[model samples]
Target: MTTTRTNKAWASNALAFATAATVTAIVTFTLHARVAADETPNSRPPMPVAQTQYKLQLSFEREQRFLGLIQAASRSQIGFEVPGAISEILVREGQAVAAGSPLASLDTQALVARRAAAAFDVDRASAELELASARTQRRAPLVKSGAISAQLFDDTRLAEKAVTSAFAAATAQLRALDIDLEKSVLRAPYAARIGRQLLDRGAVTQPGSAVFTLTSIADREAHIGVAVEQAQFLEVGQIYPLQWRSQSVRATLLAVRADVNPISMTTVAIFSVPADVEAFDGEPVSVSLPRTEPETGGWLPLSALIEGERGIWTVLALRERDNATLAVREAVEVLHVSGDQAYVRGSINDGDLVIADGVHRIAPGTLVAPISSSSVTLAEH
Candidate 1:
């Protein structure tokens, strides 16, 4: 009976130990699940990204500036009228010359000889005419007094008229020689800068051969070829703004060609540069012409433009209540592009949030978390 009682006691002890272990395990599991549930929020959403838009002015068409060449007002190739050996060269290249200044002289030996012969002829003719006049006067009185024959008087009168004609011819020859002598020396025709010398001392030059090139820069002008379509917008006397080397210059349209060039089909326009503006011949410059009235337009980052099969488009992000987001794709007409800013007209408003960076990665009606754009750091290439 004692053995049976010990067995019952052992069985009872084992049952209590098993029950205590099961209760401890249940309490530890429940506390761990509760702690995990409290640490994690089940319905948290991401933050939305912030975007920026810039206000811009819109116009019909932005003015375009074009490059052009600067040129002298006038240019001429100076030459001698007579052929002769060069005796002297007075002007040097790049020298400033005035009108009527002696530029050079040629050997005048032959011209001087011809002039002397002409003067001798004039003197001989004058002497003959004086003798004829005296004989005619003396013979007229003799004929009246019957001291000389009437035929002799007629001969004297004819001789006087013939001598008078010869004298006049000789005088004209002297004057012709004088002009030829003066032509042997070349003079500047106008104020200009001398270019390369074609003839040097002792060099023989032919008549009409270039002696030097002269260009006038006091009043400058530019000749430009304009297309037929653009020619219609240009008019004579219209003022246009020009910029060169960060300097502003005003140019006036002097004239426009009525006929178009057959080869290029372009009209030629001549513009006079302002006198005070500094420029050089054949140097290129930039011209800015205003085409439309000035007004404000919308400006957006160039990244916002999405070009696809349908053309360029932009995505505008809209925010709604309950932190919901929506995007709308709209067609945009780009007027002009300057640097990274694009002037466009579309459904976008001034304060509207347009997808700037990473525009091509997103689509319309996409849910986006608003995040600070400044927080994203771009790696430098």
Candidate 2:
């Protein structure tokens, strides 16, 4: 029993010594690793920051959009010139018609009867005119040769002249009737689309009354109202982009009216759209114009700016002072913002290194290693 107890004590002591040696070795390795890390180039380097260069600009172009309306180039109320009962309407509403296409016609039963009667009168007049001419020729010779008495010859000539006048009057009446008949039919004056049908068949219409509203399909125009100051920059015959029904279309500037709109307090600008574009009349559209603002500022990423006390803003810029690069806070006034970039003028100079992002985590005087972005990135919100 004594020998067994001694053996058990020896084994316990050996296990204890082995555990202590393992612990010591681990502690020594940790200390050596720490020392090696301290001897390296930078035990704790400055925080790396994304930066961008500031480019100073004398002015900036700001895009401004103006609303407008689309309209057909020509809209007209068309109707027949003669007063008559409507016999037929050839075209329906919204129908496309070519130039000279028949639109409607007036009832011609009475007109036809009158024209026939006038034709009979014209035929009778022609026969009478021929007989009168023969009689005048024959009577002239008779009076000269003294075969007939002077008084009788003169009476014959006078009767012939009266017949001639009567014949001319009858012929003119027939021609007038023919014109009235032709005027009873209405036709399209140009290539157009029927916008409205104002009258129906079997309705009697007077002269100059509207029968249809036709809108020209060949040409379309957009009439945009822009600010008076902005309109001055527009040039006639210049091409511009327009927004129509969520689509982009190009149009040519046609004219700028001299008068200003009283309600909108804007000037009117007219633009002509291409023929191939499918657009509706009286639709809404918009045009954008770039206007230069006279101000000196520099462009920077919006991420570089931070909000400060009441209407003030802050941006972190890298500066070298006391032989160390330090982050310097600048107070700036934002002149304009487009997409992800801002035009600002403040206590900053051209070519100043501005932190592009992550400004919240950094302090004003924190040492920073400015790693410039190779290229600036901009994205629409």
Candidate 3:
């Protein structure tokens, strides 16, 4: 048609001049990215954190532990102040005795035949007090030579004062058969070990029963019941370490029980042990104790706390200010954890810093960049 309508009006004026030079280079690149984002100056550059350096510590008091029991700070039982029949048991159940040793023997065969009938009534009362002092010294010169009558010299001076009161009742029955032959020999009062024997060899027993137990194992102890506020932090001579078997052993406290065991209502204490603690007489032993007050807390490290809520606890620390280093939070209370650390009480002080990574999301006034974990090396977690 007129040369194809002048080549379609020159391709619609070259497509409206390349759509107005692509809308004027997208409106001059969106106004030079809005004036370089308003002359850029939103500044940012802090946040590195990782910190750690609170130190000041000194709170101590939460120990507790438990397992305790081991006994034998004395243990007695050894009965036999007079019966009989166990004619010889000489110690065995764990033997090892010393102070007075002996241990058993009561077949005094009718007490050595009543001590040979009280030594034949003290040899017939020393032959009736030497025939009543030779007839009261030959009738005191025959009753002053009246020869013999004055009621026959007062009936031979009342038969020599009734033979000197039957020779003083036969020397008090030969001193009660020499104290029943020295209490039928039972012995062993201290330095001991034979913890049990009850009554072996012929048995019989009675006058107070219980034949052998003796224990003492060189003064051992370790009772532990606590809780009257842990027996008010046990005192009596204070020493305390305990553990036994797994070793440690230091003991000492020796007594706190002013009464209060009515079946573990708790409050016993008693320690002592340490004869190299081989621990026996009932055995168990663990004992820790401590806590009675004095614990304010602030150790930290359990990844620097967090758990909050009613049981409360938080941390983060770092503080500084205007020049930067923010992250402050803190709340804490924790009170004890140990192995990877954590005692906490916090409003956090003493060279503070903290933030040793409690999930480290970072925020509270952020700005961080702390770094000083003694110049860093950590890495174990």
Candidate 4:
């Protein structure tokens, strides 16, 4: 029994040893296979990129389009001088009117009757004054000759003075009535167009009540607001082209307000338009300011620039590495971006060979074969 038990223990130990050997061989083969796979050449290598060198451009203009409105150069609100119910409105909105043309009328029947009564009083007072003058002359002669009592002569002089005073008062009243009669009719103060009608005929209006709004047709303006930086470029008397609804017009810079507008936080610029150009108040228009100052930068195609860390930009330039063409990165600061072009300055000097496209396929120190871009349009200075 002891011999049989020892023989079974030996067989068990041999099985354990064989099993350990198989596991060790498997682990060793796996490690060697991984190392060999890493050392061997790749079956599918990266294809060589067809690269292009883009030339640098300098001197560009910065322009921004702004929107504004066409407005009247001068506006006036018309009102009646005397309080009365409006009797007639003779002018229509948007109608051109000459100076002194009647725009509206107030009821003048009562005023006219008073004016007639004043005229009649003036005529009667004139006849009485003539009779008083004759009596005063006759009394002067009598008082000097002592042909009549002195008291009677004094009474005659006093009567003459009283009648003369009455005559003067009546004439003053007549002159005042004539002025009121003329004011009953509202007339255009100057040659202008009716912009708006506040009240219709028969509407009761008080003195100084706005009845119509008039805008001068001979002068028009473009009222636009711009940032403080942009305002510095504008000068008084400078002419600029303005567009509205496909219509183009030229306007001369009339004024630039020093105070900033509270609502838009911009400075106001008023440009006087041509008198013949048909424009209305508050009509929207567009204007572009030509930059007089040249900016120091170079323009590159959009494909040449790459986004970098912290909102910075980068470009891959071709350089010699390992006796082969390799891409090297250069930092650039984008001054302005227009459409598919980027205007940049910094790090990238003039005549740098920057990759125009396929930047994603290229990395720093990447091997490449660069060729001149025949089809790409290079930016001009």
Best by TM-score: 2
Residues 188-304 of candidate 1 have per-residue lDDT tens digits of: 887778988987899998888999988875777877776666778887898877776688777888987889989988776778888777666777776665465454557666776
lDDT of 2 at 210: 98
TM-score of each predicted structure versus truth:
0.67, 0.82, 0.39, 0.65
Given candidate 3, what's the lDDT at residue 337? 71
Give all candidates' CA lDDT scores. 0.76, 0.89, 0.75, 0.82
Error of 4 at 221 (Å): 2.4
Compose the digit string of candidate 4's lDDT tens values, residues 185-291: 99998889998999998998998899999987777888788777788989899888888779778888999999997887888888888877777778898777755
- Model 2 lDDT, residue 187, Cα: 90
Please identify model 3 stretches exceeding 4 Å from their true place. Answer: 1-71, 75-105, 108-116, 119-123, 130-134, 141-173, 176-178, 185-194, 202-211, 216-220, 223-298, 305-350, 356-359, 363-381
Q: What is the lDDT of candidate 4?
A: 0.82
CA RMSD of all predictions: 9.1, 5.3, 13.6, 9.8
Higher TM-score: candidate 1 or 3? 1
lDDT of 2 by residue, 131-200 (tens): 8778878888878888999998788788888888888888898888788888888999999999999999
* Model 1 whole-model lDDT (C-alpha atoms): 0.76
